[model samples]
Target: MSFLPYALAAWLFFVGLYGIVTSRHFVHLVICLGVTQSSTYVLLLAIGYRTGKKAPIFTSGVPVKVGAVDPVVQALTLTDIVVGVTVAALLLALVIEIWKRAGTVDPDELRRNRT
Candidate 1:
């Protein structure tokens, strides 16, 4: 049962790779990037979950133990998510600008014009 999520995430990540390989449009590539980003998030969160661990909190009457998921990993995941979003947003913005200036988003066509 624990491996189910991992399997699904792997499958989704492969699909995203396929899209990136076969993409003919810039917008489709951006969508594929989003898909891959989500796949990593699912994988990371699944790996950090514990079967019986309580939430991370140190109350006066309750004690937090050593078996809880690492907060550092969680923080890294959050940072990765933010960075991915920033990259995707910047790429999309560049795509829009390229479309406005060149009137096309095809990478091959852009290369053609570079000559």
Candidate 2:
């Protein structure tokens, strides 16, 4: 259980990379990009995870302890999620435009259609 997230993250990253490398369509490529990016979130959270630790919120009586999980990584992971979603959305929009103009999303077809 302890090593699960780390292993999953690595597996997800490789799987996404494989998808991107073998992608035929622009949308597929974008989706693979998202999968790859998600692996990083898993990794960041896993790295920041501390067993049996409470959240870092300040309380009147709870003493601050060294065992508290680092909050910075959690924050960074959240920001990464927002940024990644925005970028993926923008990319999908571009793909939609390309499909509208090209009548296809296949990368090879688009390349051949290039004037």
- Best by the TM-score measure: 2
Residues 48-102 of candidate 2 have per-residue lDDT tens digits of 8888887767779977876677788899998999999999999999999998898
lDDT on C-alpha atoms for all candidate structures:
0.82, 0.91
Q: Write the per-residue lDDT of candidate 1 for residues 23-68, one digit (tens) a residue.
A: 8789899989888778887788788878787555656976556567
Give the deviation of candidate 2 from the true structure as CA RMSD. 2.0
C-alpha TM-score for every candidate: 0.81, 0.87
In candidate 2, where is summed lDDT lowest over 10 consecutive residues? 62-71
Candidate 1, position 52, lDDT: 80
Model 2 bad stretches (over 4 Å): 60-67
lDDT accuracy of residue 5 in candidate 1: 77
